[model samples]
Every structure is written in structure tokens, then in C-alpha cells.
Target: MPRSWVDGLEARARASLPAPVHEYVAHGAGAGTSRDEAAAAWRDVRFLPHVLHDVTDVGLATEVLGTRLETPVGVAPTSLQRAVHPDGELAMARATAAAGGLMVVSSNAGSTFADIAATGVAWWLQVYLPSDRTLALPLLERAVAAGARAVVLTVDTPVVGSWEPAGDRVWDVVDPAFTRVNFDEGHDTQPGAEKALDLGPHDLDWLAERTGLPVVAKGVLRADDARRCVQAGAAAVWVSNHGGRQLDRAVAPARALPAIVRELADDDAEVYVDGGLGSGTDVLAALGLGADAAFLGRLPLWALVEGEHGVGRLQDRIRAELVEAMRLAGCRRVADARDVVGSPAPV
Candidate 1:
């Protein structure tokens, strides 16, 4: 009901969550420059509203990778949802299904892949391949067995990036051992998270060749990088700077769209984006710039604070806001979003 659903959600989260949990969800990588840049880039997009078009019957339904989604926004994989709420990833899946969108389950999920799939949420697994490829295959196989439709291979963190999570009250209570439950109970941290996979630029082709499921490369920000991924047989290229968690001075995923879109315009793989997108307007901006889908990373943390209900409410409100944006722009469909273009149209 508020003018900005995210503002109220953020306020509530700040008031309720401990300082450390809040910091983990809020702060970006070193100096927080890219985090700021990503949000600003969306503000730079301006829709070309057609005052004459009839938008009385606007539509948001769209399809991606041969699957239907009610809206183009998706839930991105975030680690340690257990640290935020009891339901965590399952709650996120339920909310996403309810919202008619997809959820990319994190490799560090507190729940197992089969368990998340059981919620009837069409989910893809976000995998961080360790230095050893052998350890990665079983995880992929397990995800497919559990009905994962795609594998969102997270390539930004070949090795974990450094960031000191804020506050100490969390560590004083929450076990450092409790974050990961998707793997062996004895494996306290994510198994393959720390080492490089020795992956060639074309190595993704090798991985995709072995799997029955589609392999989507996430964390790409350059058109050249995106082009290489397409050549590597990536089913999709997700434009992300790891939500600005890895690199400090990186470009925002939304700002990188024009170049990446141009490179992959003729390619089969769709371009997905994430980082600093917290509202439907932000989602609309990404769509207008040619992103097939936009993933909400930090916003979901606010939703997960109240479990699935919060997520559902946030999602419902976002779709509503998207419809409003379409109506004001005099756009009748998702495809119309592209009409906005990179530069403002002639006055």
C-alpha cells in the first residue's frame, strides 16, 4: 500500500534483524562503488510513453527458455537464508511459484535440491564450481534428479571474495557450522567455493555437453565475455557483477545490458541481469533495455524476513507496480518494454 513497497520492507528489516544479518544483506563489495552504480544505471533508463496507445488490457506473462512465467522477475540465489528465517529457500520457492516466477536455488541453500523442487517451484540451481570438477557433477546430477530445469553456473567467484560481514552478535550465537545443509552435514562450508576450477573460457561447453539440463552462465558483465559464453555453449548469459559482491569497481549489470544485448542479439541464449534492482520500475528498466529476465537479490532477503508471506506480498505488489508502469507508458505488453530504447526517443 505504500508508495514504495521496498522502503517499508527495508525499514522493517532494519528494525527487526540483528546488525550482522542486516549488514550481510545490505552491504556490497569493497568501497560499495559498483553497488551504487548498478542502481543508478536503472535510473538512467527513460521509457517513451505513447499518449495515444490504449493500455487498458496490459499483459505481463512471458516465456523464457521454453518455460512460461507470469512475470519476468525472478528470485536470485542468496546464501544463508537460514540465517534470515526458518523456511529460507523453500519459502522463497513457494513465494516465487505463487508469484508465477522462477527461483534459482543457491548451492549453499540450507535445504536440499529435491526438497526445494518438492514445493512445486520451477527452480534452477546456482552452482559454484570448485577447483575440482568431479565434486561439481554430483551436485548437478542431484539437481536434475530433483527436477531442476536449468543450471545457473556462478562463475564470478572462482574463489571466495573478501568482505568482512558486519556485527558480532550473529557469530556469538549462530553457528559458523549451520549455514550449509544442501551438502554433507559434516561439510561446514560450501565444498567447492574456495578454489578455482581451472576453467577455460570455453570450458562451459564441456560442462553443458555432459549434462541433460541447460547450463546458464551467471555473473557476466562484458559483451566480449557474453560472446565467449555463447561460444562456450551457454544456454543463457546472466549479466551480473555478482551483485557487486566480488569486484569493487565493476559496472552495474543493468548498465552493461546494451553491449551484452548487442553481442547476443542474434544468439539463442537469453540475457538475464541482477544487482541493485529492488522494484518493478527497475525490472521494467531492465526489460526496456533488452534483458529477458531480471533477478532480485537483496530485495528477497527483506521478503524472507517474514517467511513466504512477505515474499508473496512483495511479489504481488511488484507485478501491480509493473502494470502501472505499463499503463503510464501506454505499453500493452512485455515486448513493448523494448520500445523505451537506450536513448530517449525524439520529442
Candidate 2:
């Protein structure tokens, strides 16, 4: 079989980047079981494609939180892009815009929201509230002023996960200027600047009320948690395990998606997911499993290793692959992507 686009990009990125840099992007918490399992779980989902359907034109367009996307696949928030490439988030924003996909800017992004938004990409801000919730206000205010269409509140990392073996070396060597440039100078030294350990459902309400932008609760795995987020004023619930970086042995998004979708069956909230989703079929599987949209975490960063063009190329290829998969599965539109996966089984 030919090398997949993601595999090819990973190989090239690994070859071009320093070992530590590559390892940082690839590392998962603890035993790496969650990261390994995330990718494997999606493959276990068997596609139950319909027969004899006219799939001449497979539509990939979909609206996410009122923002229209030419493709259902979007780039997830990954930090320190400049650590791998000079252009950093700017390059990603440009490429994602060129491909007409959404880009989620990380709280720790190397570039300013103004610069990223200036790239003309439809973007959302992914945030981790600080112990002093007020610290996030300026950050949220800036992103909204920069034209962020939504806010993805990442609630998984009450504390950053422990990446054993690699430890702090993954981040210790990165220049401080290349990460979290959005915060005030010496922000880390301030009291309550650390990630809030007391994050709760009410925090979601606070963010929505404060920003006025639709809030998407990310890092949700449990159906109960997902339901609570919507109940707390979240416009959407993103099923994720922080790409297996935050919590080791957490349930993969692919495995946890069905439960969350069922939990929010009656609510008018959109469900998004990301984690080890690397192919068109993987995306198709996610949509078929009731996801409003599937996001890519690592692949875009790996593609960004070659700059904006690489990311754009990666998007084009994935879109093509998704179209083919949808056509084969008799999915003429994003909504029609449902009921294509077989009955759930243990992964």
C-alpha cells in the first residue's frame, strides 16, 4: 500500500525536525496507551456503506456554530508552532483559510490573535482558564476583538499531564518567546496564572457570558459531562482526551463519541471530536457516529513543518479522501454521513 498523506508528513517532519521537537509533538502522557489506543479505536469501526446510491457529488460543506466551512474537517488547537516552523500559527491560519477550514488557536499559541485572524481564516480561540479567572479576560477579549467566531474552552487539563520519560525536556528547551506570547510579560510568575484546578460547569457559563461568543466545551469524554456542559450554556461539546496528552488511559474520542451523542440527543448543541483522526474514512466514521465535525490535532502541525503550503496540501488531500469515502458510503452531504458505521464493539 502507498504511504498515507499523514504518514508521509510525519516521516518528513521527523526527518527535518530535531529529535526533541518531534518527540514533543508525538509524546503522550504516562505509558502512551491513550495515544496509541486513540488511533487504533477508529480503525475498529467498520463502515456499513449503502449500495447503489448516486454519489456523483459528495458535499463536504457544513456550518459549525453558525460559521460555514467548506469541509467538515478542521485544525485543532496545537501550541508552539514556531518551535517546529518559523511562521507558526500564522502559517496554519493562512493554510487553513486557503483550504476553507476552521482553525482553533491555542491559548499557548506563539502568534498573536490579531496576526492569525489577519490571515483571513475563520478561527476560534481555545483557552485554559487560569486560577485567577480574570487573567483569561484579557486573552478572551483580545481574541474576540481579533474576530474569533467561537471559544473552545479546554477543561481537561486542570493540571498539565505528566509526560514520563520525556518529562519537561519536551518544553524546557523551547524559547519562552515561541510559546504563550499572547499573555502579558512574566505572566507565569503572577499569582493565579496557573491553570485553574477548580474548573467547573459554572466556568462555562462565565466564559459564554463574558465573551458573548459561542463556547465549545473541549476535552469532554463522558456523556454526563457533555450533557452538563450544554446545560451550563455551552453551544457545543467537543469529545476529546486532549489527544491523549492530558490523561493517560482515558477513553479515546472515537470510543466515547457515541455515548456523548446519545446523551445530547435532545439538545440543540453540536458535538465535535478530535484525537488520532488521520484519514478521510476516519473522519467519515466520526460524522457517521453523529459528530457535527471532526478535527485534526497532530497532522496539521506535522504538515506545518513544511510551512503553509504543506498544510494546504494536506487539507486538499484529506478533502479528496473524504469525498471518496463519503461517495462510497452513500453520503451525499455531511448530514447524510449518519448510520454508516456498524454496531459499536470493543476496540
Candidate 3:
């Protein structure tokens, strides 16, 4: 069989990158059970197609947090992007903008928020509040001033998760500019500058109130947690397990989605999910299970191996596949993808 898009990109990225860098990008916490199982979970979704319906004009248009998108799929934030390509997040911004997709920028981005905004991609800032919460104020202020449309507050990490010994990590040797360049000083090591261990729902309210921008609660895997986040002024809830980079054995986003979606069924808030979503059919499964949109993480990063052109190619392929999937599933618009998820037939 011809190689799938994800496998082809992963092969190219691995060939182009240093061994340590590829390991850093590909490895998950602990033994990698969560990371390893995520993609398989999405692939297991069985779509219940509505046959005999018009599919000649399947479209992927949708909106997220009030921003219009040509496609429902967007780029999920990933750190240390410069380690993968010289152009880094800038290339991602330009390519995503060209494709009319959203780009959620990592707090540890290699480029400044201003430069990213200058790429003209509709973007959101992903934030990890430091122990000295006040220290994050300046960075958050700068991002808002630079045109960040929303704040994606990652709430699952109180500390970095442990990865099994995998030789020297890439963060140790890359240029500081290839790491976090948004801070005013080298605050990554400053006293009280570590990730806050005492984060709470109140921080969600704080982020929204301070930035005057909507907040998305990222990394939530439970219905109660998601509910608390929405009640705390979150405009959206992102179902993720940090791409299995966080706690090992954590439920995959595909498995964790239905509960949260059911929990928020009557609420006005939008629900989004990410983690091992590789194909257009996977995106459709997410929508069929009540996700407003799906986000791509590792696939796009691997595509970044060729800079803007590569990522652009990845985006075009996914868009085409998604349209084809929709056509086969009888979904003419994004909204029609709902309630189509069902159990796969047994062999």
C-alpha cells in the first residue's frame, strides 16, 4: 500500500532531523503507552454514513471562538519548533494563513508574538502560567497587544512529565533563540519562574479578565473539569492529554471526548479535541462525536521539515482528504458531521 500522509511526513522528518531532536519530538511520558495508543484510538472510530445524500459539494468551512476558518482543522501548539526547521513558527504562520487555518502558538515559541502575528495567520496564544504568576503578565500583555485572538490556558501540567531516559534531549543544546524567545529575560531559570504547581480554575478567570480575550481550557480529560473550566469563563474546552507527553496511560482524546461533549451538550461553549488525529476521516469522527473542530499536532510538525512549502502541502492534502471523507459520509457542511459516530463492525 502507498504510504499514508502521516507516515510519509514522519519518515521525511526523521531523515532530516538529528536523532536526539526526533526523539524529543516523538517521545511521550514514561513508557509511551498514552502516546502510542492515541492515533490508534482515532483510527478505530466507525463512521455511520448517511447514504443517498448530495455530496457533490462537501465543504469544510467552520468557525472557532468567533473566527472563520476555511477548514475546521487547525494547527495545535508545539514547542521547540526551531529545532525542526530554521524558519520555525514563522513558516507555520504563513502557511496556515494561506490555507485559512488557525494556529495556536506555544508559550515556548521560538519567535516573538509580533512576528507571528505579522504572518497574518489567525492565531491564539497558548500559556503556561509561571510560579510567579505576575511574571506572565508582561508576556500575556504583549501577546494580546500583538493580536492574539484568544488564550489557550493549559491546565494539566503542574510539572513537566517524566520521559524514560532517551539520551540527551534537544533542549539542552539548541540555541536559546531556538527555544523560548518571547521572554524579556532568561526567566526559565529565575527563582519562582517555574511552572506553577498551584494552578486552579480561578486562573482561567484571571487570564480572560487580564487579556480581555476569551480563554480555552486545554488538556482537560474529564467532564467535571471541563465544566469547571467553562464556568470559570472559558470560551472553549480543548480535550487533550498533551499529545501523551503528559501523564502516561492518560485517556486518549478520542476516548475522552464523548463524556465531555455529553456533559456540555446544552451549554453554549465550543468543544475541541487534539491527539493523534491524523486523517480527514479522523477529523470527521471528532466532529461526529460532537467536537466543533479538530486540531493537528505532530503531523504538521513533521511537515515543517520543508518549512512553509511542506506545511502548505500537508494542509492541502488534509483538506482534500477531509472533503473526500465528508463526501463519502454525506456531510455537505461541518455541522452535519454530528451524531455519525458508531461502533465498528466486527471482522
| Most TM-score-accurate candidate | 2
**Model 1 Cα displacement at 133 (Å)?**
0.5
Ranking of models by lDDT: 2, 3, 1
For model 2, the stretches where C-alpha displacement exceeds 4 angstroms are 1-5, 345-347
| lDDT, candidate 1, 1-347, per-residue tens | 67566678878888888777787777777887887787777877776776888888998999878889989999998987877888888889899998889999888787888878888888888877666566676777778789888888887876555666644456765555445565554433555545565766665875676567788999998889898888888989999998787888887777788788889999898989898887778888888889899889988888789999999988888888889988887778898998765462111
The residue-by-residue lDDT of candidate 3 on 1-347, one tens digit each, is 22276568888889989877888889899989999989898888898888999888877789999999999999999987988999999999999999999999998999999999999999999999988888898889889999999999999999889886643567566776786788878677778898999999899999989999999999999999999998989999999999899899998898889889989999999999999988888888889888998999998899999999989988888888888888888889999999677763121
TM-score of each: 0.93, 0.97, 0.96
Question: Candidate 1 vs candidate 2: which has greater lDDT?
Answer: 2
**Model 1 misplaced stretches (Cα beyond 4 Å):** 165-171, 176-178, 185-193, 342-347
Per-prediction tally of clashes: 0, 0, 0
Model 1 TM-score, 2 decimals: 0.93
Overall lDDT per candidate, in order of appearance = 0.80, 0.90, 0.89
